[model samples]
Target: MKRVIQFATGNVGKHALPLIIERPGLELVGLHAHGPDKVGRDAADICGRSEPTGVIATKDIDALVALGADCVVYTSQAEMRPQQAIEEICRFLRAGTNVVGTSMVWLVAPQHADAWIREPLAAACAEGGTSLYINGVDPGYSGDSLVYTALTLAGRATGITVSEICDYGSYDDAEFTGVSFGFGTTPDHTPIMFAPGVLSSLWGGQVRSLADVLGVTLDEVRESHESWVTPEPIDCTMMSVAPGHVAAVRFAVEGIRDGQPVITMEHVNRLTPITAPDWPYPPDGRLGVHRVVVHGNPGVEINTRLGLDGVDHNDGGVISTAARAVNAIDAVCAAPSGLLSVKDLPAAHADRVMW
Candidate 1:
């Protein structure tokens, strides 16, 4: 069995650990958290389980390394700060431990500036004879699997378009409901690009990656946002955000070559229900849906409601998305060194991440 150490005790890692530990060929040996009094806590309890294990969470890196696990699972927030995240990843690789996590945010850091991140990370893996990969549900799905699936339906396609529509108003997280979707806001409070930019950071490369696969030269990538605010309040219990929502978010991206559009992506998030009359097709009548359309001769479109009820934006959607990031540990470990994007790695289908 592959013995593993989870490097953080956050909700993501906690949710993924039980699944990992239950895998037939895997053993979850340790739970490491940076919280105070880190050691001797039950991993299951930390994840909100009633049953507790003797396994304690810890902040001692030396202890973790000495635990002699075959690999280390990192779900740390290093991704928020690109530079430091890369540095820490290098340390894990140099320590002769296989590493995996969400810190692969540097996947597309400009090749010219901070290009050193690539070479050194690659070298570290070689030096320690280790491997790493990083991916999340957004980049992993819309960027990798969904687009890849879309390409399979096309014949000599010249362009591809993928979109994810999420009604954030139905979301519960304060960061997402209030700050992300701009629930109660004036024109000056938040720009349209706020939530859309996050999507760009995660999936823009997917567009570029598809372009690379099709040998198309991309000239420009542009994004636009749309919003709606409820005139009055309504009562709802689906998400933790405010009741009777105030705002919603939707975004679109266009990829062009020589001023000609070739690829596109759109994401929509709203607290209240929505219908897109402008879309060439009918809206899925669900709170959220991931839609991928490949533009070539006889274009093909694929749509799936990935939320709570195939149309509802429930905690299940957020939890599942976050779980995808941690459950992808082994795939990331198998990927080639250096920062990796969803397109950089293979489908995360391993006994290790199956929860």
Candidate 2:
């Protein structure tokens, strides 16, 4: 069994560690937090202690490293800059400890993460002979891995696009609400994601990844975003949302490497109590529509939804996605050294390992 050490004590880690402990080839070791106050507390305390583990949380990176853990799963909510995430990943890779973590958004996306973060991480992993993986749902699963999965249905395809649409009405966390759905702000206040350089930063790597699989070179990439606010105010635990519920955010990336454009677009909407009006709730809550449209000689259109019938995926989505953040620990250790993506590793189902 792989000895696994957790570097976070929050909800993200809390949700994952329990399941990881039960996996046949894995053993839960200890928990570490960047916070001084959390040090010395039982790992179960951090997770509400519905069950108990003797492990205590600590802030000592070196001490944790000395544990000779086969893998480290970082779930901390630390606000370290992008470079810090790279540094931490490097530390584990150098220690011969494979790493899996949820630190940043779209770490593998060619358009969003800085080269400084990427290049060093790759170098460190290669030098240490360890694998490092970064993953989550949206940019991680939806943006890249799912794109790769969708292409499986195609033969001699020209282009493809995928989108997510849903109502985030029940989500009440102010911090998350503000950033994700763009509450208390106008569309202009949010970053213009589709601009030339901007487009490449978001999901351009997905286009690049697909191109690599298809043996094509992308000549250019472009992207854009759109959001709407409800006309009146409604109350949730987080904030009193005005304008009703926000409209959808439509973000698309167009890859033009082969004289024609291959586009991928995402539509995210918080359309529950009041959505676009025509959209219906998908049993789970509101709705999330992932649509893929391919245009060419034998064109095709496909759409799917993720959450199960009774599962409220809004909150569960973040936690479930975060759980998968640690799902690649074994693969990260066994694979050749370097930065790895979810699709890069051998197949593993996160649901089977949950606490």
Superposition TM-score, candidate 1 onto the true structure? 0.79
lDDT (Cα atoms) of all candidates against the true structure:
0.61, 0.64
Tens digits of per-residue lDDT for model 2, 89-133 = 678778788888765555655333578667787777777788777
Which candidate number has the best lDDT? 2
TM-score of each: 0.79, 0.83
Superposed by TM-score, candidate 2 places the C-alpha of residue 37 at a distance from the truth, in angstroms, of 6.6
How far does residue 219 in candidate 1 sit from its true spot (Å)? 1.2
Question: lDDT score, residue 123, model 2?
Answer: 77
Cα lDDT over the full model 1: 0.61
Model 1 agreement with the true structure over 103-140: per-residue lDDT tens digits: 45445322211355567777777887777665555544
